[model samples]
Target: MSSQSRKKWTGYAITSAIIISLMIITIGIYSFEEENLKNIITKNQVEIQEIITKSISKNISSELELITFELALLAESGQLQDDLGTKESNQLISQTFDRLNSISPTAQILALDKDFKVLSQASKIHNSFVGATVKGLPDLIDSEENKTKSESKILSINTSLFDEPEIAITFPIVNKETNISNGLLLVTLPSSEFFKRHGNIYDVESQFLMVMDENNVLLIHPNMENVGKNFFDDEIQHDISYNSALNEYITHVLEGNLSTVIVTLEDNIGERINSAIPVTVNGKNEFVFGVVTPTQSINQEIDEIIFLTKIQTVFLLMSTIAVLLVFMLKRSQSFKKEKLTVIGQLSSNIAHDIRNPLGTIKNAGVIIEKENNSQNKIISREINRINLSVRRISHQIEEVLNYVRTTPMILKQHSISQTIQEAVDTLDVPPDIKINIPNNDVSIRIDHEKMLIVFVNIVLNAIQSIGKNEGNVTISIRETFSNVTIEFENSGPNIPAKDLKHIFDTLFTTKLEGTGLGLSSCKNIIEQHKGTIHVVTNPVMFSIKLPNEHSNTE
Candidate 1:
């Protein structure tokens, strides 16, 4: 082989070896990071589901509690007695019924005597009420709990007085002196009313919610026909033995503890994820709320995690390889060479711009010196301020031209206030733009010249962001026990969301004529001093935090 061919092959072999090593290292890293990513995604998805479940339970429980309270209050009013159905009794009952009628138009109220017979009612039975009866009225008496039963006061899924199913809330009117019951009052609103009220609480993913009463009978279902049926028997069914995994999961929940469960339908509707939580009605845990959704809801989170992991893995792998390849290809001509080339060009251009301003300053100075020689020299103060602004512009230009990845620093104890004033004295600010500086100053160990650059760049950016608008730029210092933060806030348009993250990135700028090195240089300077710089949008702000040793100089 020719000498050139041999050398080329040698280079190729070295590159292959390096690539193999990187691939092995990256595979190990990818395995670790992928697992971490899955855990994070799954944790976030469960948190969101828990929040939705809590909201559904709270909404349904609140509505039931309110209805029960209203029913108990009107029942204890001491007007409708057990023996008579008088005009005075009907009128008193109808007034309260009429008020609640606005919410449930078909709601009915009935007063039953001790014999469980309807004594008086403002229902649709009319005056033929001598011997009226209901289909499911006996269950509301709850005779098992003696005279102190509270299950009778809960919202029960019953359909006694109406043609269809209704939500019944019954309260007993007991004689307080005897500690015994006289009669009871029952009020039932339509099941559709409960469904209509709590169903639309969220237009989000918690759509498939099953509501059941204290007896485990389904109160509200998407299929209204399924209401008033046993939830464990009809809605949930395990294909195998009672000792199966799914059955065990269900038993765990029946044992009054929350557990995650997966159920597969025998009808091939596919697997579903279920989360069940108890609902509180009238200050008691008397109902069940279950959220059932398709398995794709969980798979979707997995898919997203996979997509994000792939993106991160590819980015890390490509960046590592690309840096190596670019270095090899440009060994004779490097990135630093190109950077210096740009810096040299900037220096020449900025130096030329500085000449005109220097000439103006020199002329102003000569006028003062010559006036002083006349022995009656009256030097204008305006000339001095203009000279100071011109000098500041020159100093900032040098900072931009000398910009590299890092700048050497000399740390000394100095007041942040002194550095800020010096930085602002260099800028030719517009009259319409107001600048406010804090009176309380804090000192820190920082490089004075480099720190001045950070402050100057921040203030100049704020002024430019305001443009011709009348805006205020406020600067303040907040000191903690170990660190002091200097903040710059401006009443300008908020930074766009898309560009906020890349604000300090090298060569990233929104301005048409910007070199994009001002903030980037500031970031480097702050970092070199072992400090951090951060920004927040919506009334743009920049905060620079530096280590402090309680250095306060009044």
Candidate 2:
């Protein structure tokens, strides 16, 4: 009786122990699965959020480009340069700027001299910006060619009439005669209010997009109260802990060491992902784009995944998956390097890599032409073809770089007839061809260097089309109160009707050696000047009609 009772009790004890062990193991498995799941989801969300952030950056850049373009058109339309510093010109320019579709009503649009003294400003708050000295803008006028691409700026944290910080976008006014920047057409808006107007990122769920300065102050935020929120203030307490990683991130931001990154932090809802990228202005980090988004939804997904699985044994999996997990973690880390950095590096590297060999090939062709001076038909023709091929490659390189290097037009007043004559003077015109200069000159505002390029390209094309034949390229200019028309009448054979329609189309060309970019670039330059270009077949004339914009100043 005693042995039987003891055996039954032993059996109950062992079964209870087994049940306890199973429960403990199940809890461990679920906990491990949740960690891994959140990691995977965080990585995916980081990529998507990074893409979203870049889009915001691009939209910012696009906004600047738009405002800059509008200012350029004002000059091209005969409005700004001549009467600068005059109240009427200021009123006209400011009024036009205020009406532009891209900026918010609170934006400040202004014109300033090279000394940073404001000539005029348009604003909803006050007209005080007209006489204020723009304290913090980098000297864009005398900077090297590389720095010219940067047209964006963030004015000092100094408060304005609206009691908000400012972000400025400028288009330089260059004096063509002296090749110096004379003034700038600028548009600025309250930094905090700027992001609210961007349709993509205003109020999306629990996500917050912000701009912070090196002083740890949030210069821009969707909430006006958050605009001055500083990360380092000891008197203020935040819902989220702002120690360790955050302070480190601030250091990285102030150091201007990062382009893009996703910062992980402990949140009330388990965890959150926040990213920040420096807004580079004139080669320095003036502000940062900080994106904060929650990761709590990912935990719910993990719970559902674990609950839905009926039969799952993951005990052996954890032991063997360490290396694979490490690899994945590394791959995720690599994504932090971001898209812009990669693409910019790749394109520049490819250009350099391609051009080095092209130069070698060009040098080799020259050596071949000189070393083997045989006048035999095959050798002579082969050398000629080699030279032509070298030229073609060189032209192709220029075309690609031109696309990469193209910047917004800088408008200045110049004479159309003089520009044409200057272009013709640079060319090695054949003895049989006559380039006739017109007696009448027309003054128009334009980007002189770009116009010079346009004129040179068109005249070169005409000369090449004439080849060895005797021909006339008669230049004519006619001006009216509103517009100026310049024509080039060449004796070359009539261009095919089919080609005439597509003449200005990008990458449209009939020549075996042409890059097809010359005419398209010319067309772009003309359009940028608020002008139009067209070709006629009868005399193969290319005509350009530009707005009669003029400036009467030194």
Candidate 3:
């Protein structure tokens, strides 16, 4: 090859290699970031699971304690000490049980004889176990084989009768003077209560939860089919066998150590992520709660993020390439200079058009006010109204003029509190109306005069809405690193829903005498300052946001 051709070929090769290397580096960094993000998400899921577990357990335990306290009070009272056969005693017990059942939907309250024959039951009647002697009592009474004990002596027996997937807590009803145990008061709470209460507290969708006894008997599964089923049985044999995930979960729980694990299960729908936390109940490591969220849900979020990142990266790369090409071409650009000159001429024309008519109206109103005669009272009142209308029109015209006149300029920060006070001072608000300002000073970068117009417009609108009713207007200002937000909230009749969207449109008026320009003018001023303005019709809240900066001294 010729020397020139060889050099060209070499250059092309080098460029291609550089491009490939950069692509590989970018992909590697993205992969690493994605993996790190996944780990962080998993960690958060585990933490949330732990929180849900602890919260649910504490709530249930609190409910149980409250129930026990109430029962203890009833048992100690002289009312129930007379006899179980009496009409009055039966009525009291029935009323008390009904109240308990209403408050705790998952609990079944029972008054049983000393031999554990049920006198009454709170839940629906089932033929399998009602009126039968309690079968699970002996095994739970601190027996050597049971490997579990109760903290409160009153809760010595676990009569969670018939493998019905409920938490059975038995407290002995004692005679006060004799100090002798008479009958057992049993409360059976289903595990569904924990799931329902947890669901109400958090907004996450789809959770599968389970509670098991120390022997791994599945006492409660939020899924009704799993209730009255033992985890060690053939159908659920996989859950109880050693080395299995559920077995490991139970072991950690029974050891009194909290553990959170994420297990993936395949079902008819698809693979799902399950987060589990083990909780100790009544001194037995028998209950485990798990929340299942679909992997598809989290995967959807990841996919959206990836798509956005790719789009942003492509745009950024194109911008960088464009800048490089422009620099290489070495062209002198005067586009901004030409644009400014045209803008300046247009602004001068707009200002002249606005100011001339405004001045004419003001002068005409003033001349009318000066005229005095036998009809002076009527003339003066009409002149005053005309002057007010002229002022409103002039303010709106000035807002447009300012927008046309001001060039791209840096905003000077000023005291927002002072500006708002000045705006309020300009309004003819009724004395019955109350206005509240925040205690702290709010500072923001904005044109002081333009900002004044915004506040005045919002406040005037609020005062007009109040009319004759006792009203309150509250102003709150908050600042952050990037932006400052000011909110004006008022209590009055709510703005009509149909008019809400049109309120900010130019020349949209709700009142007969209004110039229909206040809100529109306010919107223009905010946009010119690179800020945003929004109105919330319900409760009549208006908010404005501006850039944050150090306050200007003057």
Best by TM-score: 3
The local distance difference test score of model 3 is: 0.61
User: What is the C-alpha lDDT profile of model 2 across 212-256, one tens digit per residue?
Assistant: 764567776544565566757762235335556666766776675
Error in Å for residue 194 of model 2: 1.7
Candidate 1 lDDT, tens digit per residue, 134-245? 5456664553233364335655654445444566767776665665667677777776555544434333322366666666676665445666776567344433223266
Instruction: Sort by lDDT, best first.
Output: 1, 2, 3
Instruction: Give lDDT tens digits, candidate 3, residues 70-93.
Output: 566456556566554356655676
Prediction-by-prediction clash tally: 0, 0, 1
What TM-score, over all chains together, does every model reach?
Answer: 0.47, 0.44, 0.49
TM-score-based ranking: 3, 1, 2
Residue pairs clashing, model 2: none
Cand. 2 TM to true fold: 0.44
**Candidates 1 and 3, the one with greater lDDT:** 1
Q: Candidate 1: where is the Cα deviation over 4 Å?
A: 10-35, 81-84, 98-106, 119-131, 143-151, 158-165, 175-182, 190-196, 202-207, 220-227, 234-259, 262-272, 293-295, 301-305, 308-554
